[model samples]
Target: MAGTTLGAASPALAQKKPEAAKPAPPKLSKPVMAVVMAVQKLQQAGDHAGALAKLTEAAAVPRAEKDDALILAKLKLFSAQTIKDNAKLEEGLTEAVEAPSITPDEKLMFSKFVAGLASNRKDYGKAWTWYEFYLGQKPDDVEITVQAASVAAALKQPARVYELLTKAIDLREAKNETGDRSWYEFRAQTAIDNKMDDKLLPSLLGWVKAFPEPKSYNLAIGLVKQRQGNLDNNVLVDFGRLMSAAGAMTDANNYLEYADAALDRGMPNEAEIVLKEGIAKQLLDGSKQNIKEFVAQAASKNAESKAGLAALEKDAKTSPRLALVVADTFANLKQYDKAITWYKTLVGNAMIDQDTVNLRLAFALKNSGDAAGAKAALANVKAGPRAIIAKFMDVVIGDAA
Candidate 1:
């Protein structure tokens, strides 16, 4: 048996001869390089489709290793964004995040991108996760933390939102950074929503101290005061103190907001008094420029007697430019006939620039149970770019006339 095996091996060795090694596959060819360059150029130019096509062609080439990975990743990212496909965007971002060669900065960028896409798609849970991951890498990013807090608030996790925003505020305060009051405002608002009014007041006061130049703080303070049944001289004095430190423009807006809040809280008489005082002091001079005209019109609409309406009519006629206010006041009072009358006058006189007056008149007429009159009014409004109004009138007339 050993002699037979030796004879067989000798025959096999004699039959085979050693061959020279084949030349290694050639490196990236010029066509492959051109395709890669084209992909890069297209990517830079924001022509994602062209970039993707070139990348696909280049990927088919032999031995395109490192460049293939980069181009593929970029193509995926661009494709997701170009088509507004959030699922694809998140998938691509996840792949990029997991890539072994991706740098820390690139990974951070991918995480943010995924979070933003998730937010735009209203997938707050996914967004929160990605934002948390990004924040883990950049714990000092107050803006990102604030954004996370906002998303959490939208998700109805108020406690989490408060925690995150408090941290962000602390970080910002320590850094002596300013601007962007949205986080502070949101935190305060969330506190109000969560029934933590006591907590809200202190935070709002702190914001006012930190950003004394903004009247928004004063307005917020006034709201709290009013909510606590303190909208009196004391509230005004506090506002005056706040105004002394705020910009003039902001101070004026704060007064206006205070009045508005008073009106909202069923204290219209107080609002009127405050508005009168503001006007008298010239703090709200810019705002009051047209308010007298509005007040006269409102008084006219609310008059019990025709004699009173006549007096208001006389005032409105004296200031024909106040027709819009007169129309709005009448509309608010549910005096549709009177509103239609004023709106028509406005339309006839070209006092209102937009077709809104005609559309409003139509609505008023309809609400007053005069569908035919509304259609007629719309027909008379032949001008003022409101073909849509005409079309709407046709529909209304077809249905109810």
Candidate 2:
């Protein structure tokens, strides 16, 4: 390394002077400055009433043509807070903030009051606008973020509603939250409201896993029927069966439609089963001519198959697997006598999950009018998640025979 002489240093090698300081923010006009100082003094003196009154007086001063807008905006919030007069606060702050003079921070501060006052008045569209502006300054505030989105929804902006709701759910996910049940319900409800024709099934397919309130599931099945595309009736029957497994096939129309779809698909056996469930529940709407004729046809078909099912019953007693399978089918078909008999044979089997089998047995017995037998069957489901379900059934089964 070479040594440098201090007296003759090159220009580039010279020691640097200290950098200039940043320019200060522009000063307010004299009148605005005076009002600001006066307000500060009043505040220090605990004269909030005086400070507000003075600022209210200074709004008429003309020197602060440039800064007046922002100054007045802030003054409105101060005065309103001290007086607790929300109407004037929102009115004044709203006028001042719309001027170009307001800073990002000032907008966030006063806009909250404006939004709140608007919301209290049920002026949701105006509230949504202010909240949307507030979001620019405090983008990560979850509470405000969701409130903005909700107001957007109330204003009939369904797309914005979903967009913000998803954003909130994503924010929760970032913090390792799996999403609250209410959040999922909100999402599902949004889809339902929009009649989200194409997106309905895919949206609901995951929703019920987290929050399985029956309303959403019911809407989901309705959407499924609406969304069946050009698939054959076989596919519709399969769809109905899938909903049954998901507990979405609850309504009277669902039962009747499932039977019709099955029959149209050349699936007489499936049609027979579904119609039996509908008839037993009186959901075939016997007062309707079409329903009456359809029920008569399905009952006749089921009667023709009665001998075949009886032959299988003999084998059902020898093969417990067959009994369990037949029991599930009969239970679904509402043949409680046959289902009870077969389910009892499988209730004590080591080859099956007996608790699960007993839940089915209890279901058959409950429908069979032997409520006591159903309770006894529930007693066998003493462990696992099924135990709570069995306990629920036990309480509702009513008056054991």
Q: All models: lDDT?
A: 0.59, 0.64
Candidate 1 lDDT tens digits, 1-401: 00011111122211113439863432444666666567668867877767656655655665344433434555566655665545655665666676555557677767766676677677888888888899899988777787788678768998888788888888877877753677677778888889886577566655654555445544654556456553454234223322332332244555666555544433343345555666777877735546665344434333433334556666887576566656655654568788888887777664555445655676678768887876776676554224323443444344445
Clashing residue pairs for model 1 = none
Question: Per-residue error at 290 for model 2, in Å?
Answer: 8.5
The true-versus-predicted C-alpha distance at residue 135 of model 1, in Å, is 0.7
Winner by TM-score: 2
Instruction: Tell me, by lDDT, which candidate is best.
Output: 2
Model 1 CA RMSD to the hidden true structure, in angstroms: 23.9
Clashing pairs for model 2 are 372-400
The list of candidate 1 runs beyond 4 A from truth reads 1-71, 78-90, 226-401
